[model samples]
Target chain A: MSADAGTDADAGADVGAYADTETGADTDADANTAPDATATAAAAATAPAGTPPDATPWRRLHPLSLLVTAQLLAGAAFGAGVPVGAGLAAHIPFRAAVAWVLAGSALLLAGGLALDVLRLRHTRYRVGAERVELRTGVLFTTRRSLPRDRIRSVDLTAHPLLRLLGLVKVRIGTGDQTAGGESPLQLSPVRRAEGESLRRELLRRAGPAAGGSTEGRLAALVPRWIRYAPLSFLTPLLAMTGWGAVMQVSQWFGAEETVVDLVRDTFSPLPAGWTVLALTLLFLSAGVVGSFGTWAEMWWNYRLEREPDGTLRVRRGLLTTRSISLEEARLRGVDVVEPLGVRLSGAARVDAVATGLSRRDSEENDLSTLLPAAPRAVADEVAARVLRAPVALTRPELAPHPRAALARRLRWSLGAALVPVAVLLLLAAALSVRGLAYAGAATAAVLLPAAALLARDAYRSLGHGLAGPYLVVRSGTLRRSTVALRRDGVVGWTVRQSLFQRRAGLVTLRATTAAGAQAYAAYDVGEAQGLRFAEEAVPELLAPFLVPDDGAVEQPAERTCPDRWSPVRT
Target chain B: MQVVGIDREGRNRGPGPAGLRLRPPHHRVDRRAVAWWRTRLLLAAAVPAGVLAVLGALLGPARFWLLVAGAGVAAAGLAAGLGLPAWYYRVHRWEVTDDAVYVRTGYFWVDSRIAPMSRIQTVDTERGPLQRAFGLAAVTVTTASAKGALRIEALDHEEAAELAEQLALATQKTPGDAT
Candidate 1:
């Protein structure tokens, strides 16, 4: 053991020197913990044939990646250079200027190539028994070391250019939100096979607790699910973008004014109502096509499989392929998110309620999404499968809130509608803009009924109940979410009662959990019922606070008195 | 205090004093909290009052009543500000039990929170310059809840330290498993 520790120290010193060469000043304090040279040598020995025989455990990146990165940079610069060079040539001697531009482009590409080579040389990664370490930089070195035990995810991504060369970038992360970008050890442009094996080896845990061997295909891309893609909130957004693109394309062709004139001429021959309807149809159709194309690009070969190594892997994308593996142990439960339009079509998307999937990383959000918009039943089944449970937890019939909650929502909605009307009235009074009174009246007329309907929908959406180990809560109007959260995952409870809510005998019980949005609320429930629900959901956590409603002597609360829980000062 | 002593024995005795209001047995912080609040509130009010006084002076003798009105408002403001802190001091109370730390505070819209010992991630004590001068300290308890850290302010320095130690000891025993 002492000899092993001595060899480890020697390898550590070597790593420290290599790290110091790039950083040039600050010492890597944890250098003593660098993986042993013998182990790193063993890794290099097994690595592909052309690896240098040097004992420095610093392994360089795939050599072709440098050329690929340089070519990509040079191609982008060439595109940007052409127009400017052409414009400058009109001012100077065309031949000389063209020659100078060519020379400049060559220098730019050469500089980029040289920098990439240095960066590759400086970059080194070692997968030790306990942790994964990555050291990289040309000038400002960043050394990251993530513990193997804390490694929650390993994702492989290959953009079109890199994919053509059969290379992939590996992102090994601890799934810590506060660690930010520093937490992920990025090994850019490694050989595809090497990346895959590294992902597998690093994520492999040893325990019967790891349910690895029961591998099964949970869900695969259903081409029919593409039909639901257009029936989403993104459809309208894409439609707006389509309209923008039409104008932008015309502008690019230097015929924007002519196109606008042509559009006007076509519409002028029709009634205003017909013209509006025609334009709406045009945009909607364009949006439908756009959404279809986007869906194909995003989910073309999407496959969700439970791997033999206890990882829930999601592989998808057409042009730029992605393979993300999430440890099943980290997954708490699942959320079935249904936007208003999607919900109307009997579809919902399933999202994993897991730790380390912070919203800060857009990629994590994509990886956390277990299923795209699909039939409600399919989404529920996928959620159930992911949880390894027999029945769909979120599919339980939820206990609805009282009518007073609905009344409160309606009043709130009406008040919100009135604010807009009041704003329009003020605008009309101040500016005396044409048709101002009509606009104010129209706003009120439209918003009042819409708000009322939304309020009613919101009331209908409110519910909370227990489903085995899961505490299921459903709520929202425009975008309803039904979350089946693992009961043990809940860390604390927050009971809030505003003066108005208290007066109405309502209380909001918030279940504070580490996974999925941090806190989920059972909103505007009857105070007694809410307390009872909270107690039953957690058991013993809140049971001591309740007193029996019988006509008997009052028993004081077990821990904190009821008087202490009161929100009123007096 | 006497009522609390009687309540334990009266609890099982037929009907147990009907219509009697039950007050929490939570202990209030150091009385110096009133002074702390008064200074803080006065400091906050100074800028607006100064601006009003300046405006009154700028209006000149043609509207000398403006100066009188501004002075009256500033005086009223000061009086209310001073009185409000004292009222806040009276209401703000906290208690630390074996299982949880309970706090009741706020003047008009009072808020109460109970952070269970098992859920507490950290407990820290802070003493501002003014607080240091007054020999007062504040203890902040952080839980995994979205409401953020709960603070018990303006306790005597030594008492705050002792309370923090006790809370930390209780929290350590639970080994908070929030994440």
Candidate 2:
């Protein structure tokens, strides 16, 4: 019976040519019942007449995709039903409301399934000799193709349901950003084996093996690294989110007032200050747990490996596993990022400064992260290995900005810290509110010292220097980033001087590049020193625009040469 | 040749010494840019002022304050519209060398940019409606780096087109994917 079914499916391929006609619905129903059969049929029908039987043929996403889509829809339906059901129950019988929600969900599920069936039947992809192409859509069929050579990344991801069914979603990208932020090609829920083979086949380089002997695991998950989770900036945010969730849930049950009153009564006996501190501690502990869980989910089984062909692959995640591959040829440098909280705990993360890493991915998911928050030494070691530098590039002492830069930071920080206090005091005076005056003083007491400390840290963080083949720049107190960028990768320079900076003889020099943040700045360096640094960092690039002191003096008679023009006195 | 010497500290030291400094670019934008900027500024300011005046007449309680706000906005706009365009024309300068394009722009805050010809990816000429009316156009030279695009605003239309074409030719001669 199995053999008969297989042969019948192949035979159906010959008839499948007519499936695109008005009778597409009838063929689609067959696809819904026996998706594997239809998938094989589609492959056979799409194969060209003269091609060999075993030649690369069209393929369809796994049939279990329908189940995945159904599960997602069911989740959405459930979330929507609760609120809608409540509204209906308030106006009608509770039993009738429940019946209405069930009926709506059934209709929604049926409609979604029908659309997905059509999609499954129509969507077909083929890996040709020089290109990968996908043809899909029911009403307006679209064909998208990516050149095999230009293919930059082939990432595979699988959520719990897809993993259970031995399926994975394949995202093929040229890393060429299109107007709309969507992956160029997505083949969701392909067989795990097929997805793995596709990844290997697509990324297989043509030339001699690069990093051949060094091909092995570069880094793997260290169980102790989980200790850094609660130290992340996410902890405070998570605490706030937890509080919001509690409030929302209580409100939904119409017990918000009771919950608030209960909390008030519990804390009423204690001093207000103590109550605030205790509540904060309670929320923070909950946040610590939440962050730990999130960290585990994100970094579980994390492994960084260099493939034989020099492709760097990162495989991680617990419930939704992800495998991201990057070509070594595209890598420009790396960024050692230390958020304030993480830095305080002596840890940092490493992110790849590679070309074609999409801005959205980096912003949303930290997709370029090569290492999670780890020991500072570990981060430096990983960075050295990744960049193949003999010495750790980020370990060098950098040339600090002048004291004027520190003064500028202090001015800005103190000014910002004072604004709220000033506003509060003014309001107190105008409204004659004695409590407002005290509140203003309290705010000043907490903020003034903190602002000064941050300003000093920020000043200390501002540094730039050349290390071997890279230009290292460091800045920021809240989230300090020390980026070691390839000197060759720098495409241009932007030097800015505001009125204040001009008087202070300081300039902010920004090195513009195609990779990473696109620009890294050396803030508030001495004017001549910054220019000299830019010149030294990339020889001949800035030489034509600069005039040395002696050159300017000697060429004073050259009227047409702007290079002889004197410095603009403020 | 005439020399106006200034020291590193920005003191007018009367040609006593010379110090290393960035020279201003050679070419200034078209004089008509001043008029164009004034018109643009006035148009931008007029909307809010008109809205405030209308609201002052329509509303009863806030009429005096609204009218006063409208007058203040108009006065500030008038002063800026008259003074800023000329200052911008003085500050905005651009020069293209065989190896790179250099530009200096902005009045209150000065910005200078240099993009090497080898790194340039695209060169484009744009003429907005108002600029076209004044026979002016702007040239934008783009490098692979997002922040490295150089714009030379308010040039003679023909000159802008020629500059863009020249830049495109220069970029074509240089190889490597500009990244």
- Each prediction's whole-model lDDT (CA): 0.72, 0.80
Q: What tens-digit string does per-residue lDDT give for candidate 2 at B1-179?
A: 11235344332233233334577776677778899999999988898999999999999999999999999988889999999998898788878887888889988689899998899988889999999999999988888888888998888888788778777887889877788
Give per-model CA RMSD.
Answer: 8.4, 7.7
- Please give, for residues A1-570, the per-residue lDDT of candidate 1 as tens digits: 122465456445545453333232213422322211112333333434432223435444687897687878788667756755766777799887788778888888888888887787767777766556676665565556565766778899988878989999898877654333444677888999989998889877823468545747999989999988888767879999977877866654466899899999999999999999999999889889989988888888999988877889999999889998878877777889998988999999998887767656535456778899999999999999998878988788887776779989999999999998998899888998857878989999999999999999999999888888888889997889999988877766666667777566566777776666777888887655666676677776554334433334443333333233222222
Error of 1 at A89 (Å): 7.9
Q: Of the candidates shown, which would achieve the greatest TM-score relative to the real structure?
A: 2
Candidate 2, superposed: residue stretches over 4 Å from native: A1-55, A178-182, A206-215, A250-253, A261-274, A428-439, A549-570, B1-19, B46-67
Worst 10 residues of 2 chain A by lDDT: A30-39
Fraction of true contacts retained by every candidate, in order, equals 0.09, 0.49
What global local distance difference test value does model 2 have? 0.80
Model 1 misses residue A402 by how many Å?
A: 2.0
Looking at model 2, residue A290 earns an lDDT score of: 91
